[model samples]
Target: MGYWSSVLLVFLGSCSYGVLSTFVKLAYQAGFLPGEVSGSQMFFAMVFMWGVALLFSRRKVRGKQWLTLAGTGLATGLTGILYYQSLQYVPASIAIVLLFQFTWIGVIIESFIERRRPGVEKVAALVLLATGTLLAGGVLAGEFGSLHPVGILFGLLSAVTYALFIIFSGRVGHEISPYTRSAVMLTGSVLITFIVYPPSFLLNGALTEGLLVYALPLALFGGVIPTLFFTLGVPHVGGGLATILSAAELPMAVFMSSVVLHEKVSLLQWLGVVIILVGIAVPELSHKHRTAAVRDRG
Candidate 1:
């Protein structure tokens, strides 16, 4: 796929993730525990992704590639579990801000692994994305006064794992078909998730009790779509640009909370969302302008 196409894939994947928190919150309100919510989502996602891979994917996994891909998926599963756990101790606003630290962390990983400093456009976009996240997540609105240490740690851990996920997704087994890669990696994720959360809901009739409602949407948006899209797109775009585009998640989260959950979003939050869009555009627009100028000179 082309660069722009890959960027779109990552952006859409990020937006799908943004919707996850809302559904999690809904599930919690409906009296399901975090383990139930996360485990069911993983179980359903594993089933769905494997089904698709069996039907449509043609790529074969060579020796040790499965191990590498599955190992990388540990980061994915940990990210979900840790982030969800953090929400139990901290305000959602604070949790989101901490989770978004992945933006810079991702850039740092790219820099370290590639042994190159990030370009000016990426730095600028990171600054804007961070600033906008603060406002959009209501961290600046004084709503997140509690800084629980455990929550902060879990949130930061999630950020690190998420950063690793972005980097590894691009660099490791990227030649594999997106379908096969997604299936294997998510299989690893589901294994780890099930080990930690223990899919007890499968035996206790939680699905019949209404957890299935949240599980299906969570699986599709959080598990399947992002996994497939990231596997397909991150390899092409590289990690740095992909991280910036994934900032689309924050604004979309804010919008979804406002629209779907009837959360009160302030004007500043709206402004932050706009700023985030501008930030996400910064690199793409700068690249286009440079391309145009070079063409003119040519």
Candidate 2:
């Protein structure tokens, strides 16, 4: 039950991300730049998180903890910046495949940092994730028309940053309340984004309908909710499984795009979506079998 709860939390976080891209697209159509989108999202999310932390959380955050969570935010915040930049030149399909490399990158990072080898179970799950991402990205459907070298770099950078964020958020400041920790992390993100976009949001009609209409929802789904969910849940499951479970975002993104955005999804893409679901389940089932085996031995 505990494990399942963790899975539920990670999946919820992933789904929040799943819906975020559509909002980003809408914001762009409304004439917001990537900087504005990323900037406003972090600004609003940071403010909301701080309010939550102050009102509901009674715990006082230490200076060191602040620094650590801020570092984690640097990674998360950079993920948004870099991923958005990647989409500028590369096809979304190719960029997505590069970004999803975090699935295995997280696994590998955990392996090295923890000084442990990945078992066969973990390796198998990674294969499923990679294959599913390939299908989901329409790699075989000829959707990956062309690539940009810089966009590829940015996409890969996003994957590395995201993997680091996952690994650190799970490992750091476990004693702090999620609200407080998330606030601190978001503060770091706010700082990073402000540095990138500058203070233009103050007087540049940031509160205009175009930005406000989608910006608020983007911050909630893309920033606040996912941070809280991941901060609360990832430690319980470990980063590897949590990352795999996050594969939910790809399929959910495809489904939501089809339904809400009225985008056309190819049959092969739906097959990829099903494969992603299978990928998510493989780790859980493998863990269940191993647990049962240990129980029987005992």
Clashes of each: 0, 0
lDDT of 1 at 92: 55
Q: Give all TM-scores, in the order shown.
A: 0.95, 0.94
- Top model number, lDDT: 1
Worst 10 residues of 1 by lDDT: 89-98
Best by TM-score: 1
lDDT of 2 by residue, 57-76 (tens): 99898889989999999999
Alpha-carbon shift of residue 72 in model 1 (angstroms): 1.4
lDDT, candidate 1, residue 211?
A: 90
Clashing pairs in 2: none
Per-residue error at 229 for model 2, in Å?
A: 0.7
Worst 10 residues of 2 by lDDT: 88-97
